[model samples]
Target: MSERSERIIKHSNTFLLPDLGEGLTEAEIVRWLVKVGDVVAVDTPIAEVETAKSIVELPSPYAGVIEELHGEPGTTVPVGSPLLTVADPAGAAYRAEERAGSGNVLVGYGTVESTGSGRRRKPRVSGVSGVSENVSVARVPLVISPLVRRLARDGGVDLHELTGSGPDGLIVRRDVEHAIAFRAQPASEVRPSEVRPSAIQPSAVPATAGQPAVAGVEARTGLHELRRTPMSGFRKAVVATLTRSRAEIPEATTWVDVDATALVELRASLRTATDPGPGLLALMARFVVAGLLKYPELNGYVDTGREELVQYDGVNLGLAAQTGRGLVAPAIGNAHTLTTRGLDAEIRRLTASARDGRLTQQELTFGTFTLNNYGSFGVDGSAAIINHPQVAILGVGRIIDRPWVVDGEIAVRKLTQLSLVFDHRVCDGGTAAAFLRFVADAFENPATAFADL
Candidate 1:
């Protein structure tokens, strides 16, 4: 498209697939959502990628016209492997110009100053012989375990002040714990009218007058040297998404103790049916879908960028499946249209695909609602974060026999726990509570879920 012969018309750039979760080193490309020649915007989903945890849509970091597809569907690529390229350099430059003053850069870098017009390469490191050497030498070593070292680095905890308790008085987890506790203490205690330190200073340390000295000086060790492994594509995405979700979303959660005895009985009845009986989770899924239909308000998304709530006409229910690598949520499409049997079959199929790593990109992304069965893991109940964009996530706890008052008399019945976490920004506590109650009611009387069918 360019006139200058020296300046090639196509400026190729490689789009490396990033890791989506913690410790994920590689991911299989379930499918590509965009083809060559198609223009995509930054944050637009480019492909569905299966990580150890879930099937996640990989969004493009650059806004440009696609030039080529480097790999075929089902091909597994390590994190940082080039996935595709864009043909429009001018368009890319113009978009960068438009976002010049914005805090975000083209890649992971922060805002670029107005002075720069063209793409600039990251400065290279040359054997640490320049001014960097002096700075490196001035850096102090911190004592900590491999795990604690990584945690401290990620948590931004300064380890210099931590005292060691391991061999040769090396800093172990207890030392890090002490440092965290010390840091959490207030500088001064507060009295009725005045704030002052209680007899001891907040940062006071115990006297070592009776302590014995160790033989050798402690040296800090890096966690990377302890274990070396590549990041999986799925894990990379999970890390990015969880970090982004935690940082960008103003999430607030509330918990309610749900009486799930009726639900447990309903599931049991369904399971014991002569004809192909549905699993407990499948029945739960049906109940959730029915509840979403009943409370259409809960079946919507919050567009934080636009300050709007987008309600969907169809139900795309995502079911969380725990795989060997991590958790993966492969969604059941058009959930409202599926009958209980159809829904059960789809759940079984998707669950199998998720475990076998055979799900497509379309199956992973575009979820309307999510169900996390913490019951399988023996958890009673947990408040889970609403999967971003989607307004809510339902957590199902283990089913057990518990005593309950049925029509005034105490009796033992099958019981379970339910925890629904929703975005307070898009939905109020009352609405969320109402939706959970509706789901519980539907589970207790499953015929209500199949009234139309």
Candidate 2:
């Protein structure tokens, strides 16, 4: 369990959406496991959400019937906004007279005091989701936030005249903004001052009203326009990181061809029906560890603040994993200390977590060097971008049967390409070439590579 779990065990009137990762401000609702009126236990997963980093299961905070769901699936919700509301009899009663919020501004797991006594609200009108059919049309919805109240007051919008569209009929800033917009528009249409017995509209302003309508394709005066999508989430993050990598580091690339026939056979010989043993990647990783140990200059970082190129005492092997969601590099700490089988298991664990979008922040950070196996994509070779802060990244390409000279005789051999991208600030071509040649030599002679170990 995380250290925050101790404080997060408290029940609350509403589940405040959490910052999913690395200051992620928002997440899209993928699916909801429960609806209004559904009874849920504490920590029960109520929704599956996709943040900028990963897909997460949002758990319920209070054990009671769900009073409301703040947003529908496919909706993007901001962190700190209400996720859902639950009717916790015991917990709500404890804070009934206390309106003070938790001191933790960014995040909290404390209970919230509801309006009036701690009485259970009737299940909302079915089919309408979170709306109650019996709620008075003329009555003003509860205004909870001081910010929203002040915004409405300054805008000359009467809260009592408008019904809220938020969960459990809570008035939000967006609601006030909409009311202000409606009033500002020419009063030709039925003044949207109150809920007009019609279904409440979310913040979705019609394209013609606030902005030009472009349904995937944009309208231009002259040429044809293709689709346009707002760049968000993982793809957005990738662009930012890659852009920084290109801007900050002075990088260089080096490549070499190797005969991996011996390495393949050695791995096959170690496999059995009961235990398949480590894979070629793991063997390559062991070779990398050995190479880094010999060429320690490549296993280091460049600290621009100190204007220093610092070498690390140990190697943290970062395995670059490509998932459908995005590319994530999860590091194996102190990888040089692990044996072949142990390295394989760590690689598998990080790979699974990356694919499943369950990788923690710790798993995704702190690396001295990286191994990028682009061979899985069936590509011959690629000069990859170095993961920032780390000075080097090694890429492995696909192994294919190719003609090679063997002991002065031309023969077919399993050939693979070894590519290295290194920060020029840390080391020159000589050091990079040495590291590449070392790995290639290991692949060429696996028995000699593992002889000492």
Candidate 3:
């Protein structure tokens, strides 16, 4: 916050979810880090929400007691909506503390101070003062409580579709609870073959935001009928990114079977002499970085609108890691400056964070190049989609025993396939092929290729 904006004083304040950047308009609450009545400090992470890009932890803007939470986990919320309320008795001190936050800018982003620094909000009446004593709240309408909304979401009921029976036609918990019971009643009739146990029924979960049930339509003849898991925000973003990459970039794949016997032997020799050095992927990463330096054109993106190639000063190497959650690629900043061991440690750390679902927004994006080791999946060669905006992606396949002719004699050697997928707009086939060749040569002769390191 700026100096002028941080001087405002008030007993209570409402925090609204801020724009998370990258044009993402909504996010689903993954978990709550803080609860009501908890005393929190400025910039304290209050909740974790999964956006289209990554999972982010929202920091609180005020130091005070948490008055209320505005939503529950698994519920998607739009930006600029109330996230929570905080009550601070010493508003002046809290306002001062707000100015001293970590450099990471997040919630309570925009600050515009009104004329009066001591402005307060109008309080609502605690009791009915002008109405009949026996009036029922069922007559109300609109502006329902967060708890009521959460109940409706859990029960797979759409509050907007039902007519509120509360005072002023306001929807309450009871209304949503009744709707759940109403839907819980089975259909008038059911065939033994069509009906499965309730545990396997996909209808329990809503297909869309408001409509309940992922309707199981029986096709006349096909084997596609089964339960379904709707693509989450993460999964959907993966689809959109891959789809856009395929549509926009004209990509080509080329692969070569490389004798990795020398690379394996190099690592084995290192393990005996020094602290078991970085993994093979780290050695491959070192080679990739060196290759990019030799062939810089393959390390950039093409700006279609401006008609130019945008080259980066340093490499942010993205590691494509697969976890139980889904696919995620967290970048290692300034990979060009790191040693093989340093790169290995960084990769391990990011992989742990990715698996734990704790990777921040920065770690999940902004990569100049990507290295995908699909070998761990026991697959050989892949014509992968270019992680959009990146000119190329290199994939490594499983290393296994294979026959090779060494100086006219047949020999058994450990071999692996190296595949490269590159955007045609940035460079031609010659440049792309050279880059892959450089990497493959490094793998075949690790001693000579990595001698400089």
Ranking by TM-score: 3, 2, 1
What is candidate 2's local distance difference test score?
0.74
Query: Following a full C-alpha superposition, what root-mean-square deviation does model 1 have from the true structure?
Result: 17.2
Q: Per-residue CA lDDT of candidate 3, range 266-356, in tens? A: 8887685648789888899999999998889888888898899888888999999998768888899999999999999999999989988
Candidate 2 — which residues are off by over 4 angstroms? 1-12, 19-23, 90-232
For every candidate, C-alpha RMSD to the true structure in Å: 17.2, 10.2, 10.6
Tens digits of per-residue lDDT, candidate 2, 58-128, equal 89877876656676565678899988888675544444333344221111112332335654233222222
Q: All candidates' TM-scores?
A: 0.53, 0.69, 0.72
Candidate 2 total steric clashes: 0
> What is the C-alpha lDDT profile of model 1 across 1-453, one tens digit per residue?
123322323454678988564566777877789865468888888998766556677888877777555565656778888887775667556545645545323221122333246553332212211213222211323232244555455544554444444444444454554444444545544321121122212322222444422212112321112222455656666676667667766666655555566665666676644675777778788878878887777778777778888888989999988886566678899998887788899998998887877776678776888999988988788867666667778988887777878899998876777788776777777887888887776665566655743
Q: Candidate 3 vs. truth: CA RMSD? A: 10.6
Candidate 2: TM-score?
0.69
**What residue pairs are clashing in model 2?**
none
Best by TM-score: 3
